[model samples]
Target: MENSPSVKSVAYPYGLMLAIYSILVLVLIYLMNIDQENWVIGTVNSLVTIVLYILALRTFKKKNGGFMKLKEALKVGLAIAAISGIISAVYAYIHYSFVYPEFLDMMYEKSYLDITERNMPQAQTDQALELSKMTLSPLFFATTTLILNLFFGFLISLIVGLIMKRENPAYQ
Candidate 1:
């Protein structure tokens, strides 16, 4: 029954899920372009990040394979997150770097001023800019994006694995 549904089919849904996530991220960015404050980009992205892991686990289950081992499930979930996150990060980097370079400057200036205005230490403002730069950098942003994805993915996979896993019970 090699042709029958198996964990092998996980590839299809996993790919589709990631594709959808990517598209959604793009739409979120577009919305941000319209109104920066209205941008819940990080939140939406983080939530979808979790969705990707859960979808991967669900697909794995649908494949009729042996119950997912915790380790294997974790690996699969993290992998999906890493790939999806990197893609989204890259897209954002390009959009900001080329399409909207001013956005970065705006964010930087706003934070710098806000911190100073609030009587916060200069170091805090500098620190915020430093962190933001790392995230805004095309290269570093992509790398951190992958790391963030893997980090969250691992946690999600662990939790989803606990819920989704099913071992065949003996009842004969």
Candidate 2:
């Protein structure tokens, strides 16, 4: 246990990676709302995120060890993802609950109006509103957020492990 690296050593990589992802998400949200036809922004953002995550993974490996075992890498990556998810989700909750309590209402009203204007089915609008309300629940939001981020982490770990694993040659 004494020889095992403490969790503190992993914090920096986890936090820095999340910060980068968050910035990308904010930009994506802004672009998406600004121009529906400019979905290229999202594609570019996702590619850059993958590249950044890979870079961060390489950096973490270099700093932590030349090679990281699969389980260890997965653990560190998931830990980071979980922390970031919780932080981001909490911020979202606060933002919606206090900073902009009317956002949900506004969204519901706009969606309902849009549905009517388009002569779309009323059930679609009602379903969207219900889903929005469910998202307002802290527990559900946090769990889903964590699961989503952890899924990304798992993918990053799979790639990083392929690049970073260095099991000793058994014959040696």
Candidate 3:
């Protein structure tokens, strides 16, 4: 009988693909001069993530003779998420710190405008901008990116795993 593929073996390649795809999208957005806070970009990224998770789970199921446990699916999904998150975090750090130092300033300016447009009092606006500055730092960005990826990844994995789980007859 052929050996079943390991989670790492299946996940690493998919994770790398996801990271590359995400970076490419970011580059495309930047090249096209789209706002960093665009909802369309977020929607696209979310859809891509869901599709990749489904594809990865399908690949694993196919390799394992069309059977996959919930645990196996969860493991594969989380592994892919972690690997991709780490790579993306590193890239975010470098991109924010060096490749586009002005990006933070732009975000800050946008935030200020948004707050003022809401007719926020001066004190509240000052406080909000202060909070925004901290949140927009490179370290904060990298950490938040990793955390949000893991969070959304887990949610996607849980739902997908529940839907796709098929126990091996021999093990039942």
Candidate 4:
């Protein structure tokens, strides 16, 4: 146990790798002029996160002598997710604030169009747009993104941990 690497040590590197991969996807979307709201992009990102979680957990388990408690797996997975989320949030803030200041406006226009397409009454449309505007801020974006990542990360890690957990024989 003392010879095994700590969870943080294993998680940090994988977390950074995930963050970089996520950022690269974002950059690709931006450069390709693709809609940022694309569902496919989100799906791909989610898949990548799952894969990274598996890799990180597996690496930790192997290093720990092929033994990993559910709690230990959870801890490593959550740590990786937290690290990636924090970095991604910061990047998003920067991207929206300076790299592409018009992103908020673009999202607002898209929301307005969507609301209008619903054929809602003028009053209802206005109310919806108002709510959308409130949520379009950079800080809000970062906060929600970080929260969602942690939420999904927790869910995925719970399942993966349940499947992959192995008790140390000596402890038994």
Among all candidates shown, the one with the greatest TM-score: 4
lDDT for model 4: 0.86
For all candidates in order, the CA lDDT equals: 0.65, 0.61, 0.87, 0.86
Number of backbone collisions per candidate: 2, 0, 0, 0
Across residues 74-163, which tens digit of lDDT does each residue of candidate 3 receive? 899889989989998988888889888798888889888887888888899889889988998999999987888788778898899999
Winner on TM-score (2 vs 3): 3
lDDT of model 4 at position 152: 76
Question: Pairing residues by index, what is the TM-score of model 2?
Answer: 0.65
RMSD of 1: 4.6
RMSD of 4: 2.0
Candidate 4 positional error at 45, Å: 2.1
For model 1, where is the 10-residue window of minimal lDDT? 1-10
Clashing pairs in 4: none
Write the residue-wise lDDT of candidate 2 on 1-172 in tens digits. 1133644467456555675576456545644555523577658755765665566556556655455566666676666667666666666565555655565566667655665676546787677657766764545644666677678867877777677766434322
Which of the predicted structures, 2 or 3, would earn the higher lDDT when compared with the native?
A: 3
lDDT of model 2 at position 167: 45
Q: Model 1: residues >4 Å from true position, as ranges? A: 1-16, 31-49, 120-136, 168-172
| Lowest lDDT block of 10, candidate 4 | 1-10
Error of 1 at 160 (Å): 0.3
